[model samples]
Target: MPNAANESSEGTGFQPGDGVVEEASELQEASSADRTPEEEFLAQMLAASGATNLKEAGLYDPAEVAAEEERIEEEMSPEERQAKAEHDALAAAFSMIRERSNEGKLTTPGTWAAAGIVPDHLIPVDFSDLAFDEIIAAQAASAAAKKVAEEAAQAVVADADADAVSADSSVEDVAASDSKADEAADENAPSVDEGDSLDSEIETPEWKLDDIKVLEGKQTYLYSSDYMTDTYAHWAFLAEEGDDALTLVDNAREESRLYPRPMLAASLSSKPYYWNAEQIEQAWQAVQESGSYPDINTCEASNGERYFYSTDYLSDAQAKALAEWYSVERYMNV
Candidate 1:
């Protein structure tokens, strides 16, 4: 058995496993004290370098490690200091230039100064190394473009003035021709007094014409549809009751003729009439049932919606064209 009094004073009251820890701590303290500064530094370096063992300790060269650091107290000469300051200034200027260039602003020193980014002292350095030539060329090109736009605008104005003069001349010529036509018509027309005198002078006719004179006019009458006249009586009877069905068909026919376009049945439910959904559907059904009107045609779109147009007002070709135009222009948009 070990005697309590015989234990070392430094490791008094040691537990059963404390003897190994105490010995290790004492050995480490003794080793640390015996080591010189270089050895201590080398050991610290070894730890910092993450050396697992002494075999990997060649990661540092001890010869390069000086015992003492040497720093000369000689101040920088004016030229050297100025050169260092210029280098720093140039670096700062280039940094600002690159940053502004990335932001799509002009990279000139003047622009930088206006933006309050570059310092006044940093502006006078060597910026010739930057792509100033390219910037200048771009500016010159922009000026040239502006000049060309101005010239083109002037040319357009001149052409408009010439057109105005030509239009004035044409209007004057039309006025002169109209004046001559009016004079001829007035000379040929029977005045009120002359008509009265002729009635008084002749009981019947003094001369008989052998040939009839034909006046030149348009070949076709405007909006003259045989189908409209044929269908008018039926439409008139249906519209006499002021029914929405007749109104729908009447508007479809009239507007289709005037605008030369197909009319969507849905458009009838909006504005000036404001028919409800049921009313519009009822009117549309009535239009389909009325077989007396053969010129009424309906086109069904891809979405299974029907639009109505009247062939009484439009030819077959015109109605087809209008349907196609409405499919792209109105139906697709809606």
Candidate 2:
């Protein structure tokens, strides 16, 4: 009989009864006995590629393989997971450490001094950094200024009071002297003016009564005064004309004497320009029937102009009547 392994190889196609076939059979047997399938495949690839050793063939070293095995085990283990978690926590704390280190560098002058750092010392300190004596001095200055102002104000008040007292004394002296002069005049007047008696003096003619007129269809009253010494004298004429005239006269009496004369003239002239001839006739009839206008003012014969006088100026009511007439005329013409 043949050799047992050789007989087994001949049963398969590896043996064709030649020397080369016999060598192949021996190699196959050696591989089957010594190597796993994976190793055998690696070795076959390495030989075909003409590499001399495992390292040259790009095959992993024993150390690297062992490390790969440990890595796989660690990935699957809870202890490895805990160790990785601890490493991540350490990395996160690195930023806090860096910030604390920077803060320490800023606060501790000795740290910067060791590194030869120089301070600028340029920032200013406020009142909070002032010495106690300096603070007290500032407060004293403020109090002194306030006291000076108060002293000046008190001096002014004292001077004003002294002037007021002097003025009061002068006024009292003047009033006493005037009283004495009035008494002397009263005692001496009747003996010296026998020929020039008060009644024989040329009586100042009062403003003529029948000369005033209000225009037709108008509510205004007009007057003229040729020789009146003051505008205020005219109000006596209004008082005699009853309520309408008296009401206006009272208001005028209260007005200031400084009001312009032309404004007073315009206020008394309230003839509406746009009234038709019929309306004019009706208004004229009303005024003539009432007989109220002539007692209130005088009119001029030269141009049918009327005038009134008062110490106080004509009031807003009288002014508004004239303005309304002018506005109506203007609008109608437009």
Candidate 3:
């Protein structure tokens, strides 16, 4: 007989290393060949998913995956990162869709179409169930409300016009009454008498100096410079003569620097008594003869008031005459 093992192998058609192991080896080789295409398809899917690398898709070892993830993150442009973020958001939304679909809360497009509830983008929305009758009722109510408001406004305007007419009538009546009252008052007023008028008898108050008296034993009068030297002194002497003749003399003396002639002239002339022409002439002559007559320029009266004139032309006799004329007392106390 041939070798028993060889006889059995020949019966089974088995050769050395040509059994199931060889077949398995061949299958592994074919799988290896298919693996390249499968890997390429997976890479394309991952690219479409916006995964940066196999590591992001959980296809690499932990250490290698970490390195790959870092490399992918580093290598990605800003735009790529943005795109990846959008893809992630879309994936999350899809995941939510899937979860809701699984939970029966959301229906698929096929289901929606079968139920006659297609998306508005794909089909015109049907509003058959809408309550159009209620909308019509609301519109009618709005129109009725607007009409009521207009009617109310018209009523208010009519009322306001009536009130304005009444007010205007009242105002006209008031004005007429006031006019009548003014006319009545004018008719009832008393007439004034021309002869007995207050203006005829009322004497104007004169600004005469008071409490003026000659100091004894002093030929020349003395007075406070500041008190009598201003424009008011001239005004006082020019005012109407009064009982205050001495006061007028004092004022003039003070204003004219104690010039005796000007002081007396101002005092006598300011007296209110009506002197005759002869008396006036006599008074004037006395003033001319006064020894203390002020110089011409300083002696001239200004604003109708006598002031001490300043001049070199005044003679001694004229000065003496002026002083004597002014010295006569116009009023004497008994």
Candidate 4:
């Protein structure tokens, strides 16, 4: 006689894996019945969004959403496909930037482009500490990076336009077009002449500034790096070492403390720069002669140690007292 299990299986016409499928179906039903408020809301949203599987709609299921999106995109025309992809890329890039800005982590901007949001060929542009301050020369440097992203987006449009050019298009006409493009590029390109000022090319960052405004208009948003960069780059002339020194000094000055020359010297003389005392002095002298940062100056302690400060941010007497403490008194306490 056959076993009771064999008889039951035969009576139901059950196949392998059929039990698992039925169990899954029952569990899904049970989950639907027991949905929490957020899950129920997600299910309703997925239903309204025309998702094929409302049960798969949740914060944890991006792969499913992407698969659904890819399926919908497959039905669009080539032009529609390209436009949608580009739009989504820009949306992702800007959204990530805005969110990071709120959290104050927007220091290395090239990471924004490198995070797979931008086209693959342009990922190498993410290596900058862009501050975008009109108050400093780095604003022009910042624009240089922004320009690269702009050019990449524009290149896509240019390629499409090139495809539309008539096969019989004349050489002279193309040359004339090329010449005009070159002229426009030359006119807008940022100047980087040694010892020259970039004040002309500067535009007020996407927020208010304490000093000068390069471009005249209202800014609607923040770059999250603004708060941190403002203190560091406000007096920068686009020189990296000098700007970093300013950052160290300004941070100390804020708390009525003086930044030590030994610390500043050690930081600058290390690794890639290896800037010596003479170079540091020459750089400072250049800054002084330029008079762009009249408020910035140095003080010496009784021990002959030097300290930096900005008159705009610190009082002369207060800075002198702190210079002594940083040079001598702090060591005694230690």
Candidate 5:
């Protein structure tokens, strides 16, 4: 008896024989020596998907399905058709964006401690969009880093007690050690514990951070280049990704500019690379002065907290209002 299913699959670029992969592949290829691009694409895809027989696979005819879709569109009202078109466009746009985003990834050194978690390819690094994932990841990373820092500090303290090492740490002299200990304690970073003693052997399995701080308002940069030996990396630059990298700072600034919000200094203080108060102030100045972030502007709240906003995103009055709401008013109620 002749099979109708086999006959139907003849022109669909999929073959139905004994439902064997090897047989199907041969039959499908032989069916069309001069196949169109669409046919080739469909045939290759169907084969890859392990579609042996169209009848069992429940395959639909592309031409018929497309024609039906066209007919449905023709039946739709103008507004309904417009809405469908918009929805499809949005869906396609999202698909393309996600696809493009997967092409590249960001990474960081283990020495970065908790901050290392941000560029681990968990989220996209593009700054054109203000994604909540990035902000959440940053906050989580900061917290994790701070906790690890405290643990590492305590470990050093224990090691020192065990070894009977004096306060005059080999990393520096007695005076310098005391000065650094005071500086670490005085550092207004969000609960960063550098320990009572300034220890340089702050290595752990999770982190091998000798030092991430900038002394004399100039810290060592993560990336060293031949032209410049400056200790500071621009808040907007990602060392691994080159100048093309758009930082969390840039993302925050863009969010502020586009969304009419404020980026708080206290929020950014968690990053060890720019944790120093004087270094942060100087770096922020240099970043703005570089002319890349011309839209970025700084304003101080009544409580003496600093924040940045974009002129492109908000007027001075609007920026001040929001900064106050978050930095002051929000806290007052809490």
Candidate 6:
């Protein structure tokens, strides 16, 4: 006739006799009946810790959480629960595989073992069988493309050298022609008047320049002899000191053994030489008519803008080869 529940609690590993059973029963009842969200959260955290207090369990022990998960799986429906377990296992295996690959490690069975992700019979077949051939084929194609580009670049260099020689020849021819003309002019000059002194000046030849439209804030100047001679050399010489179009093109021929590409009309309006729209057009027209550099040519891009290149430095075929190589190289780098 002692308290029957107290006797039961005493028979268990708990302390006896002091109304412990009733106190524990009441606490359980209160938790089940009206637990607040904060209390429920603490209960879960404590369960994950597998200890009476958080400090005793060292915060949240992963081993305890894993045990709790196993306990949860035991309560779920067999079919749904087994499927979910397999999915989680596969996800973990794949995550290890991806991490190995990201670390620049080879994807082999050894790598999977190192990551502690052994291949399971229930998972799919070997990944190498699925993807290795395709990857190798792609790499081969890339290598071939790079080889082609390198060959094209070599061809461009050869063409540039040949064009430079041709440009030099053209310059020599111009110099010789000028020398001959000077000799002929001296021979044809009328005899000076007997009354004239030896140091008397000769009258300059009369020449005229055509008027050109210019930007409002700028002025254009032309030498009369430039119009009369209508030569690329004369035009280049007559071009203003700061004028870049003619000088830029000429210097490219002399220094680099390369030609400046055709320029956009709008592109010339700004920068080191601010050529007006009309001026650029006129200058290009004069270049075409000068018949000086036979190798000088123009080509258009897909954007419908024309660019100039000197054949005197590189032939058309050589230029095309170099261009294709560069285009491929750029694409690969990208």
Model 6 C-alpha RMSD vs. true structure (Å) is 38.8
Candidate 6 residue-wise lDDT, 171-217, digit = tens: 78757655555554444343465214312332211111121111111
Model 5 stretches with alpha carbons more than 4 Å out: 1-249, 257-259, 271-274
Model 2 lDDT tens row, 185-235:
444344436425532443322212222221212122222222221232234
TM-score of candidate 6 versus the correct structure, residues matched by position? 0.23
TM-score: which candidate is best? 4
* Order of the predicted models by TM-score, top scorer first: 4, 5, 1, 6, 3, 2
Tally clashes: model 1.
Answer: 0
Candidate 3 on 1-334: residue-level lDDT in tens?
A: 1122222233444223322333333333454445566555655645566655443444433454455445555556665554444334323333433343333233222332354433232331221111123223444555555565566456555554444444434777767655655554444332366323433343322211121111112121211222433333333333322323333334444534544344434444432334444544454454456644444322432223333322343344554445444443222222
Enumerate clash totals for all models, in the order shown.
0, 10, 24, 1, 2, 5
Minimum summed lDDT over a 10-residue window in model 2 is located at 122-131
Tell me the whole-model lDDT of each prediction, alpha carbons only.
0.49, 0.37, 0.38, 0.48, 0.48, 0.43
Clashing pairs in 1: none
Which ten contiguous residues of candidate 6 have the minimum total lDDT?
205-214
Q: Largest lDDT belongs to which candidate?
A: 1
Residue 53 in candidate 4 has what lDDT? Answer: 42
Per-residue alpha-carbon lDDT of candidate 5 for residues 278-300, written as tens digits (9 for 90 to 100): 74576577766677777777788
Compared with the true structure, the alpha-carbon lDDT of candidate 4 equals 0.48
Off by over 4 Å in 3: 1-59, 107-334
Off by over 4 Å in 1: 1-241, 329-334
Clashing pairs in 6: 163-312, 261-308, 262-307, 262-308, 295-311
Better of 3 and 5 by lDDT: 5
